[model samples]
Target: MTKESMMLPARTYSVSIDRDWRALYEEIWQPEYFTKWASGLAESDLRADGDGWLADGPEGPIRIRFTPHNDYGVMDHFVDADTGSEVHIPLRVVQNGDGAEVMLTLYRQPGMSDEKFAADAKWINGDLKALKALFTPQRGRNG
Candidate 1:
């Protein structure tokens, strides 16, 4: 790899959720749930439009196109940041033991600072935690 490529390696993060891969995929991989758990859309409103969805991004209104759910658990998407730039996010859910692991692979774009990358990683971690908590069973009142 070139020195420049080495400096901007793809970052991957995964979280193990105590749920079936299919179940989790069905529950979380939807346009309605983007704002619910996705860090990038935390403050965005995603709504279905003609072919894709319209979303409010950090810059401004953005267009989002998501890959259809498949048996292989590939849930990738593209977000148009309104600057003639489109970012492709690769995500997957792989079966792991009794549960499943949700993995997100993020590519470090050119000119991205180390601090910004760290912050993005932290944000992804928080989103994964929130996803896990959403599926975790609640304790009983008397217990």
Candidate 2:
């Protein structure tokens, strides 16, 4: 098996949004918004006695569980291609002047290759660019 197929790796990405932390966190970190960011990124309804749930991501079904982070003013959770592990993800939102910064840190499965790592980083950067555009004001003629 390839390195990526055997272990989890840790990765971090940050985004600066032109909005308050609380409002930005609430508005952008929802099931609907996730879906809009990428096709099929919606939360699934959980039935009683359910062990796990899925997020319909564009790539495929991404397994997830909703976790709360009170002080950060946002709900967070773990998401992966599998759900039968002890893996849990923690996300945070920080206030940065009138704008907000969001940091996403994920512990990817170990044994992941350098190429895979590079690809993941590139994907995250692209995603953040899209996210910033979504929240930032468009350039208008001022001068």
Candidate 3:
């Protein structure tokens, strides 16, 4: 591979939500809702920035541009750092039986240690769990 072209190691993590695929995508495809579960992307505030958004990440403030709403369940977004580093996050919701499956692909950047990658995977899984919890049925004592 050329120095300018690099392919990073990647992994796709998914969660199953007991909701209709199209309905689930329609409800959660907005960038605003992303902050609710995608902790890795937003630690707190995520405000609009024209076509994209300005969010508070762990390192610092980052710019995120999300794909326009589509008929297909594609919520891909690009996170841009101040240092010119950009991370492509491909998120999707697809039909699984009567429920829906949400998927996020995480890529291990150059110089990222295996331990860090593993931790990132764990973090992604946790985020996916949080997303799943949004649709999971809650049992209250009153019920």
Note the Cα lDDT for every prediction shown: 0.83, 0.63, 0.89
Ranking by TM-score: 3, 1, 2
The segments of candidate 1 whose C-alpha lies over 4 angstroms from its true place after superposition are 1-8, 140-143
TM-score, model 1 to reference? 0.86
- Candidate 1, residues 107-141, lDDT tens digits: the string is 78778899988987888788888878788888999
lDDT of 3 by residue, 81-117 (tens): 7769788989999999998999999999888999999
For candidate 2, the TM-score is: 0.69
Q: Which ten residues in a row have the lowest lDDT in candidate 2?
A: 39-48
Winner by TM-score: 3
Tell me the lDDT of model 3 at 92: 91
Per-candidate TM-scores read 0.86, 0.69, 0.90
Q: Which digits, one per residue and each the tens of the lDDT, describe model 2 over residues 61-102?
A: 567666543556554666665545544655667898987987
Total colliding residue pairs, candidate 3:
0
